[model samples]
Target chain A: MKQTQALNLQQKTIKALGVNTSDAKVSLSYLSVAFLTLLIGGILGLVQGLERAGLMELPPWINYYQVLTAHGILLLLVFSTTFTIGYQYANLSHALGGLLPKVRKFAWTGFILMVIGVVLAVTMVVLNEASVLYTFYPPLAAHPVFYIGLVFVVLGIFACCIGVFINYRHWRKNHPGQTTPLLAFFAMGVFVLWFFASIGVTVEVLTLIPWSMGIVETTNVMVGRTLFWWFGHSLVNIWYLVATSAWYVIVPKIIGGRHFNEKLIRLVVILLVILNIPGGFHHQIIDPGISESIKFLHVFMSLSIAVPSLMTAFAMFAVLERAGRRKGGKGLLGWIGKLPWGDVRFLAPMIAMIAFIPGGAGGIVNTSNQMNQVIHNTLWVVGHFHVTVGMSVVMTFFGICYWLIPYLAKRKLTPQMNRLGVIQTIIWTVGMILMAGSQHLAGLLGDPRRTSYTTYGDHPTALSWVPYEYVMGIGATLLLLGVIIQVYAVINMMFFAPKGKTAFPVSEPEDGAPSAPMWTERWGLWVVLLLMVVAMAYVVPIVDMIVNAPPGSPPIRTW
Target chain B: MKQFLYGLVLYLFLLLPPVAALLESIMIIHMHMQMPLLILSGFLMARLIQLKFPDFFRKWNSNGVPGIMLFSIILVYWMIPRTMDEALTIEASELFKFISLPFLAGVPLRDSWKKISSAGKNSVFIIFIILFSLMGWLYIAADEQICNNYLRVDQITLGWGYVTMAVCMAIYVIQLIFGDHSEYK
Candidate 1:
């Protein structure tokens, strides 16, 4: 008899969540696209480094603005975004106890739309017709194709989103009256948030796509910025929220031998779902027409998102304290010392949470209206965002991939990239710091983001920044070096890593419904909803200013 | 469908590094191209070579340490006299300006990461990333990188921007070297 009989579809939903894990045909395809995009983005970044320092010169086709515009759009919009949504489609739905109906058909459509969108966008950008910094901020505009490309990409995501929603909802309906699993809820929240987030940007793109192509006359810049931020701020936070969801469960399961305080975990989820929405206004701090009071409100809500983080941190620490005590750990922070030092899963989260400290620091500064001006539009802002967004969220994605490839693809990431999670975590953390720091300093000195050339005319008083740009370039080299190694490691894993095929049986929930604490079931839903309303109260007025600002008041100049 | 997505990403990836070089080559064909493209090509080549083969390439990735030890005699005796007069009172080049100034890998002494633990790991870099940004807050409090800053700070600045990124990243890498959050050990 076979070692294990293949379970019916229902059981496979939970235990065999990986849709195509065992099949080399499926896994390799996804990995190829993912790796290619990542590598391309990495090279573009290094090119930017060279440009900033005026190390090499080239054609208008490869100009700083052109490269940056392409790099910015491709990396965030096409690369990371695709991997994120795609991974969720292939893996998370089953992981969340849902079945993907018509999976093959769905994948075909999603993949097609995405490719078409990316190709069209790249073509337009390379043509020198549309070099708008990835933002839809106007009177600056791109060729109509850029907007059309974006529409297709968004449509693809919506396809994935619809599939995910249907599956999750079905899982809940069949399971009935059981509160939604935390991961499931988060996946759903991400879907809803993304759907909502796309709204403002979608409208802006629709309005501007025509004008950029000369299909229409002038459109309002203030309105455009406001709408884009409505999408932008929330968009980044959605990444934060999604990444953190895995953290809460992954960390405890790593250290606790059993899971941690359920009520606390539930509270964090509810807090995140609510706290994330209102903070988008922070992106508009210095923009004219946004009310001062409204900006303050967004900042407050942004900070409020920190509550769940703090709560999770404390609870996570408590779990660590228990584990440490069990192992006889005793010292200032000896508990951390005693945990499994070699286990990649446990170690990855430790590195992630530790990095979260800096990620959090940048978050606070970014939302501050007055402080934003000091660092706004400089490398500092870029550094702040990349670290928070890059290290915190992206690292989570990396960590999960490290853990998942083995479980899903049945292969280990090896020559044993000894303590893979721990080592990469530390390297990435360092890279984020060095890169963000130099960028911050460069930005503070008035070096603009997305500029390919910094050694331009009559800015002699800023001679000091020239060296700083090189300093930053060196930092980027180090970061890119780490990334290159990581790419190699990921590739090695696909072909060479150890494989594990023994599957766990489909079982009851981690904690039965009754055992799941009471306050968790009761308060989480209400608190998140209430917080969402309060946050919107702040975001609404700021948006109103953008919506209402008369045609062209003229953006205030630094001089 | 999958092939299309695959082609676009791969093409773009392979296309970027060559962009500068390709742009430069355009001049050979057209007889006039931007000066920035020429300079950019050099940087791109260095970057591409470095990434493609960190340990293999001889001209670029030559072990600065061993290569230096072996070539020192030739460099000191022959090149010193030939270039000594020009080394001083030199002006920075406009296009290759980054070359004229000092490059700070901070002595390139090697071993930023201990044999036992790498300081350049993603994890430790993150913790330092936090402190590095807070450095600005600290500077604001002291009324310098601290004082007239905070919400009261004025202008979009390079000092805070680049320096904060540098300090944050530097501390993370350095901490990996100095601290023993050595997951492997």
Candidate 2:
């Protein structure tokens, strides 16, 4: 009994002292890399957009494809991965009281490995040795060094995953019969998805290494494409899962409300983990070699993700409505008006959540068998991801920075900084609407993606897309401005904001809410289920691709 | 009652010609997916039966040994490639498969599971693991098609499916051995 009280007191002291300095340093370093990548990637995006709009010309040394490749890799892969790690690690440390010593070492090892990997990859891109774009789909082969660098990135991710698993297991052992803190649970979900999602891409990259080196005469293009999507699609959800973690836990506290039912949250996490990897097939809907029946089954698998997403939408509204009503707001729609609209911490993710309604609908269009053929290689697909990833996921990450950076740096978010964040959020939302909305319209009008500026002798249909392209260029410029302000806000909060303690806003469960079930903690079972689902989804089509082999293709350089 | 209704709905859905044809068209799906789903439906439906005839279960399978034995025999009978071929070709065998797998195998397995000792449960997993490994090896290494209904490539796919299933079961057993469940529970 005395030991229990002492332990509780010790934990309270740790919480009062704020995030541990060593842990804060690790998270802050990762955040710095993430924002730095965003700055560079944002610049590249502006260049590409203006060039695509026929407003700018690239010099002989630099090309549009190289800029596009770097933009995709830096923003999509590096920025998201680094920010998730930094933010999730901070959550783990704050929630678990502190990370295990070896876990901290593992985190540093991962950071170093990832940094080295990124440097190698970006150098290859800059030197024009590899401009295969982010997907790296063969017969457009990259330098063997680029693929090897990707191997390093996957290995680095594995290091972080192992660290999280070890820490989770240690906590479970120490606290018998007690559920982990909600944020720590979210951390576990994020890393579990990360570990599994990377497997398919790792396999693809390993094969490409041999093929790219001419060690193998040719590679199976269909298998390569299939494997890439398996990883590619899951990467989308990893970001979604990370964003939803903030929505479910952090946002509620920011709005002064208890979180929704704990069981539903855990269930959403589990469902997302299990149903995620197979959804990658929808990305390959128009790709050949897979039979129609298998594609039909895959369509079902892909749509299964909507179930959890809808559940999340329902839960978020419930939390907001309840919180608003408690503050004396009346009537059915009046609660919407009562939310913290002025707070950047709430406003950014609030708009992010709103963006997902359209974003998710666009996804369904892409997943459909017929609709995919209509916009297969069009900018509509590009527009879909930009809204989904750019607004829905990245904006949430932006909101998190408002509080997260300050908490990690032991600083207060001054009102001026908060006001700047609100402005940045507004600019970002407006920019994305103009950019992604026009991209969708142009895509429907037959504009292709990943292609340099071409007028096709001033063809009428081709000329029709020019106006949308210009709007995209203008929107891209606005977005770059937003990115600059965001980076500034992050830096200001991290180093220059007034020094004081800030709370990590993990919310409590509502009064009378039942505890999450013990079965939800059985991660081993969840993993086995995940493996079984993957096996079921992949075995048929993959086997057919291998057994009925076509003549494989040698490397081709399109540029 | 809810379980029974869910089971009935699943069973009826599986009975649909298009659904069954689509699932059975792929050899691995026929065995691994369709067969397991049939068993799941029966497992769920068994709750109603257990409630309806508690005395029947108590008297015939008091220790769960008899029920488990019945399940093992029926499951083994279905795993034979010749049996799968026969069910596709001969309508009588098909009827027997539909009847025997659910009523004899799945229902009895569900009743037997909780009543069995932990060691007995482990033994069941061990048996399946060995069976799956042998099946995987036989199907993968065979020169000729193992089943007349399935193409050689389909047989190979089923072989890989068996191999993956065995790997999954092995992982489960290993975790069961090493994991200290009391820590979390």
TM-score of chain A of each: 0.86, 0.98
**Every candidate's lDDT:** 0.57, 0.92
Model 1 agreement with the true structure over A496-554: per-residue lDDT tens digits: 77765523111233455344543343322333354334334433453344335565522
**Which parts of model 1 are misplaced by more than 4 Å?**
A1-9, A12-32, A96-98, A419-426, A455-461, A502-514, A517-548, A552-559, B1-185
- Tell me model 1's lDDT, rounded to 2 decimals: 0.57
Candidate 2 lDDT (Cα, 0 to 1): 0.92
**Error at A359, model 1, angstroms:** 2.1
Q: What is the C-alpha RMSD of each candidate to the true structure, in Å?
A: 27.5, 1.6
Tell me, by lDDT, which candidate is best.
Answer: 2
Estimate TM-scores for all models: 0.67, 0.98
Expressed as tens digits, the lDDT of each residue in A19-129 for candidate 2 is: 788888989999999999999999999999999999999999999999999999999999999999999999998888787789999999999999999998989999898
lDDT of 1 at A255: 56
DockQ of all candidate complexes: 0.01, 0.70
Error in Å for residue A375 of model 2: 1.3
